[model samples]
Target: MSDPIAARPAQDRAGIRVICNDHSGRNSREAEAIDLAMKVLGPQAELCHVKGSDITETARAAVRDGYATVVAAGGDGTIMAVASALNGTDCTLGMLPLGTFNFFARGYDIPEDPEGAARVIAAGHAQTIDLGAVNGRLFLNNASIGVYPAILKERETVYRRWGRRRIAAHWSVLKTFWRFRRPLKVEIEVEGQRRRFRTPLVFAARSAFQLEHFGLQGADCIRDGGFSVFVTPDVGRLGLLSDALRLAVKQMRLGEDFELICADRLVIHTKRKRQLVACDGEKFLMDGPLEFTMVRDAFRIFTPPPGDEAAA
Candidate 1:
């Protein structure tokens, strides 16, 4: 079947609305990039600087106001927020990638440099892309339960206390690992097969770029329009730490510490009625059993043409 997300011809750049998050990254360059983007997009484009909470409503308002393209100028979380509002809509989504790690933007081949990304937006080519949903909440990158969310919580606390830095992130990791020792007992149903696992993490990935970013060899699964479910086995602290190190170094073999399952849909059941889930860096306490589904070609995203590295 022909991919529904195949590239479309460039659209008019006159009616573009950019929804920017004020708190994306610590670097002054992001602010400069936003300014540069506004200049590149010209007077016709509408730029709205918003707090994290207002992203969705602002994007939706843009759509209601009939914008040809609604640009998300922030990180994965910011993009995902705007995406949740724009998914299944006809409006094209543009990305500025003004974050520490722009997994979605970079994965889609959007340039890391703000000026370069702005140029791509001005050019105005768009392609449809898939999104993953957990309990009906959309995610552009991936969703996870277990140690990941704990780590994120700690990372936020540490970031606030010590200011954001690489060492703070590492310290958060150590703190989370030391404090969280309980593994989740989950019953996962996929492809008509039922299996139970005692594990520390369950990851549902929608972006091939994220898989490749982690040096995992399964981008094809994402391209096939399914969730690549990664489950960490019931490894102890030392084992978990070792596997994490291997993953960091890109040497963690699949089927060893982690089991990968590709599925169009999955059911993850746990004893608790509500559990914390991390979706593209946002935290939610959602009710289980969590139903995960792949929404193929759910988002129409602006990008430079394929093979156009110079634009990137």
Candidate 2:
């Protein structure tokens, strides 16, 4: 397929600022990575360390200061935080993927190596892309409620004990499923149609590359400018566990594994006033009647050149 994203004009190198998260999952050598990044980015670019909660404000400040590019040097969560401020603005978003999964960065062909990624930023090639939003918050990949959020909550505990590894993430899923009970009862509204579902998880996906990477369906729908909402059947705990295993091995099937719903906008309501919603690996306690929507051409991001095989 031909690349749908077109590159924008080159940005001013002197106006670049990188906000880095030292606590990212794969950033064990944060000091070394930062030093390498600065050298590759040149003396013109600025780099600073900032906590997660302060990323948005810092990015906004950079924009106000006439920065041409604001790079997020961390995981998807950190990227999303900076995106919240840059979305709809002229400043392009750059990334150094220092996360465990690095799904968002990988999807755009952004390098995981800090110095290599810094070189991409220096090149100043960018493309406009869509982003998913839930109740006004932006997410680069996905957002979910139910079992997925529960898994994230458990994953933190496991990470604390075992450090942040892919194994620990997988382990948390199994542990959460073993103790999981009570499937959520949710009312969903899509395109003026209302439906009810009782399920263990409701996942809303915005990244076609992520779904394709996982061997799941709905990548085309997402590329066509919509979100794919996957609702797991109210299969009992044992059945859910079986499906989880299938997912781990990339052996999951449609219909039996999940019922897919595609829409540009949707609303979900549950009994609880507030629920734990996981967005790109970060958890948020949000109010009910959750709204999920896609914002097309939401922001510009630094990416590999068009027709680059890695981006494809």
Candidate 3:
């Protein structure tokens, strides 16, 4: 595809700012590409590095500084933080995928390479997308409780010891599953319909691509509005392990292994006063009765036009 920014005048690309996470994958390499891209774009195109904790405030400051576009250069967590800050704003959010999965970026067809994604940002095509929220905390991907959050907690420890690789992530999952063998008893309300469940996990997905990836149907249910909630029925450890294996191989069937529900507003209640919830790979200890809602066209994002592959 032709370069979008190349067709536009140089002055039009000047009002862009890039906020990069220093801890993202291969930070040095990402920084080099981003810096080079900024120089190519124009003198007014600014780049700044920020710690993960400061991404939200830094993005808000960029908006306050009158930047027309703010690019998030990191993983899903970094992107979500910046998105939370830019929610309901006119400023466009640009993605420079530098994470392990880059689910949100890939779903939107954003390039994985820093330089290629940078070119798309320079091209400046923007689209409106939905946002998911859990108890006021916004997320770009999905949120979950039970086994999902437990796996993330274990993944951090394994990541620290073995480095962040796919093998280490899988190892973490095995260890978490072996350690946490009990199912959680909970009540869930979806679109005013209530059901109680004894399950190993419950996942609420906003990204249709992610839902399709797991082989769990119902992407169309959430395409218009609402979330696709996945609940794993009461199963033994061996059964749970079998389900995990199916998910790994992309062979999971919803009715046999889990249940899928579609709802605009969901309320989850657990015995504990506070629970650890995982949202887009980040874990948070939030108070119960967890409330989830979907907001349509909450923000604008710069993405590659449909069917346009990243430049090699």
lDDT tens per residue, model 2, 76-124: 8899988888877777898988877889998877877877788777776
Backbone clashes under 3 angstroms, per model: 0, 0, 1
- After superposition, the stretches of candidate 3 with alpha carbons farther than 4 Å from their true spots are 1-14, 26-28, 307-312
Candidate 2 off by > 4 Å? 1-14, 308-312
Model 2, residue 215: distance off in Å is: 0.8
TM-score of each: 0.92, 0.92, 0.90
- Which residue pairs come into collision in candidate 2? none
Question: Per-model C-alpha lDDT, please?
Answer: 0.83, 0.84, 0.82
User: In candidate 2, how many Å is residue 8 off?
Assistant: 19
Q: Candidate 1, which segments miss by more than 4 Å at Cα?
A: 1-14, 162-167
RMSD to the true structure for each prediction, in A, is 4.0, 4.7, 5.5
Model 3 TM-score relative to the real fold = 0.90
Error in Å for residue 85 of model 1: 0.6
Span of 10 residues, lowest total lDDT, candidate 1: 1-10
Q: Tens digits of per-residue lDDT for model 3 on 1-312?
A: 122222433234338778888877743566677766676557767888899999998988877666778889888888998988778766789888888778899888777888788778877778998788999888988999999899998988987787666678787877777777878889998767789999989899888887777666878877867788899987777777777788888888878888888888899999989988999999999999999987777778988876666543
